[model samples]
Target: MDTILDALQEGRLFELLDNDKTDALQFLAHIIEAFPEVPAGTDVVGHVMKREEAMNTALGKGWACPHARVPFDEDLKCVIGWSPEGIDYGAPDGKPVVLVVMYLVPENQRNHYLREISFLARALENYPGLDKLRKVEDLDDIRNYLLDLIDVSKEPSGPDTRARMIRLQARTAPETLVFQDLSNLIVEPVTLVAGQNTEPVVLTQNHALFEWLDSVKDLIGRIETEGVYQNGGWRVVRRGAVNYQGSRIVYDCVAFKLIQNRPEKYK
Candidate 1:
């Protein structure tokens, strides 16, 4: 089975300028023409739309994965499109779609197709990664970003695993704050919360706040708060280090919690 990176690299990535879902699919079909494995009479758009008729493929956070299993004997193929202005993809979150990843797989590759889709859904759930994807203008950069994510995903899961987070303070600051996992990508404006009068503000999962605490930083101990209603909302707390200008800054970061008002699932 071809990995996600293999499918991505073997496929095409381009911008879909000001087009709806149907038009976007058509454009992808045209792009797929360059692939020699796809039969000359294959109806790429038709296959995708037929799948959509059964169910919309929009997986929220401004992403959609529309796929179809073709009657071919080739490996899985992908076509990734980015729409900076967003498109109406019928997402459950009511958010316009910014990224569309289309897949054309062989009929016998059902397991591989499902695994790829599931992995993408989990990866897209990371707000920080989604935020970075929105600002990606270069196609190569987008490819590299996805590749880096695959590497990060391979890192062993443990108590010390660190999820990516954005340092809200540097959003508007002149100096650029960079994280190793994520490069110099600017934090999306939506991730920042307007503070009342303090430099320290309560961070949320939407803000990409909590993850594993860095032990190399200052000697402050980590604290885990159980189901607290403080910080203007109900959230679990875990202290972690955020990399800022030449130092590791520690903060009482808020972690994700199961709440009644949680955002709807992206189907």
Candidate 2:
């Protein structure tokens, strides 16, 4: 779903053009023309126009990502276009628009389309060194720059790393669980050693909690007898939230549970 990198790698996404918006539209038409299953020529233009009637996808960074969720059999496709001279498209900033990245996605593919839009939104949000975008006159340069930027963006963003732990499904409600940066959670650093038993296992889902415990099963199994942690495949403690009176204390901390569950509501 990462932009420019995914688009260029897909091969059919790139489109070189002169300094004009009409060319941009025509180029997009050509790209859709190649996909005969979705009709052709002016039909593609009609799709774009219909979507545009709802709202301008242009957020005004001298760029716009016009998109439509068209009915199709396969995944999504992107058609990239550039105009060096820039054209008046009534951008929010009242600036002339120079580049257009059109996204055509299948209606049924909600996740892929949303993910692609998210990636595109992030890329455009940074608007980092967009003067480079102004200079790109052909498809090759655009492809190279886009690929390079996407590569740079992959180097472990802190929030992104935390978010990676939970494999969120598209149909899953967004108000149940969320990723919160531990760095932001505390006023100062709170370092805990690996041996710290008091450290709470904070997770919103059953799988995540189980996964963490499963990863450190050896440590848990040998804690009482050996008083040491070792890598071994052993049966670890499984608290089913049923036992009231037991040799060891095992109770769900409502604070930690609430902490893990609250963030998704805000999102």
Candidate 3:
């Protein structure tokens, strides 16, 4: 399976004329027309429209992902469109959608299709490249900016990039823990509170972990994991433990073993 960046390069990327006449369906139709290799007799626009009717694909913050599954020979095909003035996408936040990324995947590639959407959504949720994308006027520059954004997402977590796991044990309460990481791969913190007397509580600020896991899975597509690691592909490298403020807090580092071998590169 090709990475999202690879598929994007193989597909089309262009800018749309932002006007009072443009709507969601028109935007989707434009993308469908851009791809000529879509199998004959395939109603690409209808497929996408049907999916949209089922659920609004508009993700707030000026972004929308409209996808369709079709009878195609290839795993997937993508087309990214940018509208500077934005369009009324009926988003949850009621914000105009400025970016539309449409995916047309083969029916058999269910897992790949889902993974692609997940990655794209998470990548754009807090992407730092949006500002740069808005500034560039040329099509080639926009493409390069997207490639650079993907390159940054594919960066390997190094020694400096670490997640701090804090295990907090209270006096009467059983125990609670938090995983905080400043890695470029995931910038949010995951906190889990568990104990015998109290109900378990989980506080997640964002989909950072989900995004990282998906990216790693895509990087190691279909690879066998025999000697990868005894503990299921993840190895918790011990950093150290510490006691603080009436709680036993343990600090440890977590990383994916498979990612160490395969560093991402854009060709």
lDDT of 2 by residue, 11-38 (tens): 4443333344544554464344344345
Best by TM-score: 1
Q: Model 1: residues >4 Å from true position, as ranges? A: 1-3, 155-267
User: Once model 2 is optimally superposed onto the true structure by TM-score, how far is the C-alpha of residue 206 displaced, in angstroms?
Assistant: 64
Return the lDDT, model 3, position 236.
19
lDDT for 157 in candidate 3 is: 27
Number of backbone collisions per candidate: 0, 0, 0
Clash list (residue pairs), candidate 1? none
Which candidate has the top score in lDDT?
Answer: 1
In order of appearance, the predictions have TM-scores of: 0.54, 0.50, 0.50
lDDT per residue as tens, model 3, 1-267: 134453343434545543222243444453343344555446666778788889988877677778777876665666677676677888898877766777777777768778766765676765777667556675556655666565455433221121111101112333222111101121123333333343323344334433443344222211111111113333212112233453323222223222223323210
Question: Which sequence of candidate numbers ranks them by lDDT, best first?
Answer: 1, 3, 2
Candidate 1, after superposition: displacement of residue 239 in Å? 48
Per-residue alpha-carbon lDDT of model 1 for 241-267, expressed as tens digits?
A: 334553434343322222233333310
